[model samples]
Target chain A: MITIFGKPLLLLYGQLTLGLINGAFYALLSLGLAVIFGLLNIINFAHGALFMLGGFVAWALLEYLDIGYWPALVLAPLIVGVFGVVMEKTLINRLYKLDHLYGLLLTFGCALIIEGLARNEFGSSGVPYPIPDELRGPLDLGFMMLPAYRAWVVVAAAGVCLATWLVIEKTRIGSTLRAATENAPLVQAFGVNVPRLITLTYGAGVALAAFAGVLAAPIYSVNPNMGANFIITVFAVVVIGGMGSILGSIVTGFGLGILEGLTKVYYPQASATVVFMVMVIVLLARPAGLFGKA
Target chain B: MPMSRRALLATAAATALPVRPARAEKPTLKIGVLTDLSGPYKDLAGPGAVDAARMAVEESGLAAKGINIEVLSANHQNKADVGASVAREWYDRDGVDIILEVANSGVALAVAGVTKEKNKVYINSGAATSDLTGAQCNANTIHWVYDTYMLAHSTGAAMVKTGGDSWFLIVADYAFGHALQRDSTDFVQKAGGTVLGAVRYPFPSTTDFSSFLVQGQASGAKVLGLASAGTDVINLIKQAHEFGIKMRIAGLLIFLTDVHSLGLEVSQGLTLTESFYWDLNADTRRFADKFARRQPGRRPTMVHAGVYSSGLHYLKTVGDMGLAQARADGAATVARMKATPTSDDCFGPGSIRADGRKLCPAYLFEVKKPSESKGPWDYYKLLATTPADEAFRPLSASACPLVKA
Candidate 1:
């Protein structure tokens, strides 16, 4: 008979792989949210709906224009980003001077309208999105099988996160964006076009979310409720990682996912609540979070 | 006589003539169709159930009998409070006499409580928890269509009898999954099987199932039982295939909708038990044809079919005896339903069990091979039939308070 510890190690590796896939999604979504929050200081409650829109756009592109995954990966984010730019200009820009909670409420209303429209059009049943032929099969690890699409998601997500971090930290234009985040008026006085920068930043954030949605379409069901279900957990992830830290969000997202996977292997009942429990403990011990700056 | 006096005398004579009493308006029997119109179960029950209720009304000819069948719907959003409030509003203000097609068990159980309080009849066709008929049994609520017990009995018992005795469970971590796993395990053990071990999975989990599949493979169980439904089932099956856990797998509570969603590539050769299949019999075929006309290329799910059958019977009862009297005498109406052989487009000649679970032959279906070369919707080939007697839990085994009474 196999010992409990002996089986759990193999089980832990399996869960970690699964957790990493989920963490990839969390990292992508939170990275976008962090970018938007850094400049705008308004939590985009409609982020989930925007992610859902990305999937819908991909589905529509496939159904209407015979567009496939490669084009959709490029097209969905661009289209959704344009919409986000318009949203920032028309609706979100007006609430910048008010309490941050007002912006949250406004975004919440927008989310409702978007989700309601999707529900009306698609009904509740999810439509299947076929995986691209290249990403269809599994890679046989000696101990476990790895899905090609899932492995791609992890690699692509890490690439996106690192790219975003490097651009913000190293580039001159990124320094201007950071300066605008600190004081928009001061940056504007220096001819930085802070408002336009803010709008572009918001659009970029939304585009990232859409990109994640495109990545997730083949893995999960493309349904209206898909984003709403995941957004809450992402919010918890963001909170636990601290909203301000870009690298913190990415690291915590992936780490927590592996932790959740391990819990599923050893104690499955607590898998759902384990992340939340970790969040609570972090809040009590170190409110700034592990990677968060004080 | 004078001219004016003669005119008055004629008018008085006309007024004095006897007139026939105005025909009494037939009492309208209000039926409320409550379901999750905008929640997780919406696709399963939402418009499909409403369409089912409409079909039942048309079939029963209740409109011709001066029975006003008013169908009211609401989106409960899977909240017990919203469901109960809707039931109350329908009962108190809308004059709703019967509530049908509640999908969420939490909402269904709450609505059952409200129906009991209001003395209105509830025909539950959507909720799967067996407790509505068990500990929470109400005199006015009937557990229609399917429940956890039926699912466990048919799938688990049948597997055990076939000598696939040892069991491992991949259960969703919730009340529904827990009940399904527990009930099915009991049946497995009673049929001379051993439950090796079980694993709980969180609801809406999107990660890989390699870990859980590995656990099941290590358990050394001959049969791996999945106690979750919908996308969870799809993911589990897909992962199980990828991991190559070739144990005899059984889905304890899979629906035709689940099978359709999964398609043959993933679901092929899997054994599942279902009370109704669109291709089962001539009567079912006819019903599917009519249902397809309304929904356009979608066969009615068992729950949708259940709504139609339960609604038709309820209307028949209302037509035979008035709504007030039907509510006053619950058992008599159920007795009438049992005595009468029900023939519908969905299921033919089905009867109601004493425990209120509709009795019909359930089929163990194996997903057809890819080479079967049939058109769309030609998914399953029937394996074996569990006759009505063996299809559901026996009344003696049911712990429903009413059964003991």
Candidate 2:
């Protein structure tokens, strides 16, 4: 093994890779939050709950319907996306005209109800979802052995983030979305159907969270509180990256995740609180965030 | 949000309507099983514990003596604040005579103070921290079953003797985990083993232990010690298996349910210690058979057995003296319980110490291999049993003010 600064390079490599994997989840979750906030101007406090719903739905599909991972990967997000549409049409639509705090409160209530229901059904003990057979063993990367599934998570999450950034930053529909965010009335006068677009945008943002949940099911045990655990750190990530910029959220999520991994190696006690510390620092320095246009 | 006039009228009507028969003549003995009904320790101490308590009351023949025994239960959700509030409510408004089966140590510690303040009894079965008897000891609380000291003494010493020395600890960042790590580390050192390092992950929220496992592997320790319980144990073991880490893993605080969750494939060969096991002896099996009748597929965990042992002993104490007299003074009733020896089919025979800790022998159990399984719930094979006196902390070492010089 290569030695770096009197420590084995494989050990540092393993930690950094794990950090990147954790960052990938943060990036996907935060990107969705940014997209929703960009158009709706309301923070999706239930984003984490929706993510948990995604994993549960995937687990249910595998358990009840005998649908395997491949099908669940595609179907889970769609099912959650539809649930998001229904939530937006029914409860969230009514709160858009009120204070943003109302939207936050409503979503927070939705999260609690969802979590409580899941807890009642599943209990707090997490049920295991096996890693797919193909991704079961370790990949012998000459210097270090990386678990195949973890490698897939890092690559898959990065690919999803990149694709999402491309779709929003390029193409005509993406331009329409940006223009609507700037001036909804102007886009409406152009026969753009801004309301329908808003509903779909919210649905799409929620779909991203659900997708991340499906990806996480095999790695983390499927449980009710899983979303609640990650959501707070992700909120810190969104704040550090700013609420309105998708690219900023993606970059900040991964950066903080790696930083957290490094903290675990050098100073293990601060790993949990490190993300929030970075958030505080970022807020103090750049009131609007790293990439947010102030 | 003022109450509607209609709601005020209804409240007034309800308050004016109810008057029951005199409670002084036939007072009810209410036993509240405050536990984690939905959280991590649920399977270990939730509905199963309630069943154990009910069975104790049923088998005690207290009904023949006109002692109206009532059992109430609630989910603490593993939060200390929530547990304290529920315990407060149970004592103040509900008239719950005693509270038992607090599983999480943090929750148990929080509720212990409340029970002491309210002059009610608490019998802890699930919490692992010995401080419940040592520093946090009170007249109103009795720590039944097992504690971290017993587990560390039994398992850590066993592992070290088996040549699984040089240690790396992955501890849950909480009170119980800290106690387990501290107590077990002392045992490891006493056994002439060295501890390389330890990593503490946030409790409850940490799902992935891959990075932690990597750190453990790099520590170059022969044994990896897990100072956590419930799902955290299951996840850590599963991830370690996935990583193909060959180091002997010392499970500091685990239950049969955690093994069941991991399945024999992953949990096989794990050695842990417990105060009771269903298949340990004939007496344990007899109680286990009856318990299985209610909770069909699952076996009685040590904590569930503790509930029955403590519950049976508590009711016998209540039945000897009238419920009205016992209900008047919680500390006096606990003193009477301490005066009597603890005996039940589950935990054979033991005695409650002056510090409110029930002294019982702890058995070391090695998880059975998959091929060794004869049928369902056939999990463990007994390795060795640590005698009662040697298993727990000495009274001289206890910091409890209740322990007179």
Candidate 3:
């Protein structure tokens, strides 16, 4: 019966919860983008397509190999990660010496080609991916009936983001990767295998995207345009969180998600554009982003 | 005969230069299919529409009747500006006499304006806005297949009668979605149902509908009216199933392709209405099979079927009143079409009203369950059929300028 700003508390709680669920995806996706941009200084526009590829891979695995969601959770990301590695060695590696614009252009082109191919192979309507049996039903959360799969997404994404944050900010491998990003030639001089580390970092970032894609498969239609739909928002998250600020992205992603969720409740039509609106405000005030070291 | 001499002269002209004939020896007409080839509604009516129009041209027997059909197509990309410019170019430079299947309602309206200004025929099959046959109806346009009015009446009234007496409308914020929502609301109210609430979400982008779905649940409405089409409706239903929301969903403008995208398990028990089903009859089955051969592993939606039906009817009109007459005067051609009762393999027998509204029976269908479905693409099972006259907005209530006040 409680009210906040004349809206029911129960309504606010429900929308906020749903917003956090969306925030989980934004956090996970932007976390990957942050890692790659931090280490490689490359804006990976192909991240969305890679995410779509992950969903498609999971779909193909189930369709062809009779594999299910649990196995696809691991296999899809691994498959997409390897694709990332191969792409780095053959195509993306060449772009490192050029301006960052080249890398962005290259990856954007890659995204278009990938999406076009998917449309041709599977048509525009896209095919279905079933919700895992364990996560099929809703769990009564008092305020609302939250789907168990959505709850799993929030939990899994937070866990993965925390783990990624730990590896980057706390571990020995993380320090080496950081050092290599700071001075790749010097790290190579010190015998750290910097080139290989950079390639692996890109692969890891892409793997995270694929993992999110796999997570999204059951909930959203596995359409080619799915990535196109989400990627622009993820890029905005990366920008607002500060291009390579890890914790910043994680926080901003969830925060903006809550904001968007509230928009859906209050003014449903602006819910989709609310994130970008916030991005413009943040960029105007803090040019280097909320957490960026200006 | 004059036809053979005209053919010889045309061939001679073809070898030398492109020729424009003044009168009939044989009538030649160019067709352009402007549709959403690669956007949100692409799956609903894209290249398949073009293909269906092509089929109609081939099957019209117009070639034997000494008519030349050249079909050209373009992706409108669901943009009104893009559609209008393409239509203008098709009419002016390419000599396209008729434009068919401008899919998006906004784009369809835009092309309708251009077709009128240019005095070219437009037989729209994809768009669902009833405004085409109502306040904004034009002499150049014949709204073929179905409209929001018919779909709304069939599904909305049917749902209310079946005890889904209260509604929450989840509308796509667009011309088509608005029209669907408005029409459905009227029918629901007339059927003694109450509207609990409504929400309009941004179209072509709002992929996540969990918040909207939860809001619908919060209203405690018995039925959630979906005033949207294509994957928007598909994703909403999928998310609704995921949330295990207790409210029944009434998808007002669902397409065959949208149901196919959702699969049987998720879309089962969802009821909708359409003018054409691939399995409606032997003739439809035959039409679907030929279409499938052209677009392998895929069957046509009602929009696609409508494209064929309208194209076939248009060709019949051209054949009936020689192609030259049909080509020169768009209004006169539309008048002739309205005067004659149309019969085709897809729509069976139908008629076009003076308001350019195509009259045909609308079938209420429930999506078959996983167990009930015999095979892939075996989606809908008919529940009821609304007779042609009662299916649409009656002439007495028409707001079209063509309909005498």
> Highest TM-score among the candidates is held by which one?
3
Ranking by lDDT: 3, 2, 1
Residue-level lDDT tens digits of model 2 in B1-405 = 999999999999999996986757565789999988876778788999999999999999988877788999998988889999999999999999998889888889999899899888899998888988998899989999999999999999999999988999999987778888999999999999989999999876677788899999988899999998887888889888878888998898889888876768878999899888898889999999999999887799999999998999999998887777889999999999999988889877789999998999989999999899887679999999999988899999999889955
RMSD of each: 7.6, 3.7, 6.1
> Which of 1 and 3 is ahead in DockQ?
3
For all candidates, state DockQ relative to the true structure. Answer: 0.32, 0.57, 0.65
Please list the C-alpha lDDT of all candidates, in the order they appear.
0.81, 0.89, 0.91
Range of the 10 consecutive residues with the lowest summed lDDT in candidate 2 chain B: B20-29
Q: Pick the DockQ winner.
A: 3
lDDT of 3 by residue, A23-135 (tens): 99999999999999999999999999999999999999999999999999999999999999999999999999999999999999999999988987887878899999998
When 1 and 3 are scored with lDDT, the better candidate is 3
Model 1 / residue A72 / CA error / Å: 2.1
Q: How far off is residue A196 in model 2, in Å?
A: 2.7
For model 1, the docking class works out as acceptable
Fnat of each candidate: 0.35, 0.45, 0.73
Q: Which stretches of candidate 3 lie over 4 Å from their true place?
A: B1-27
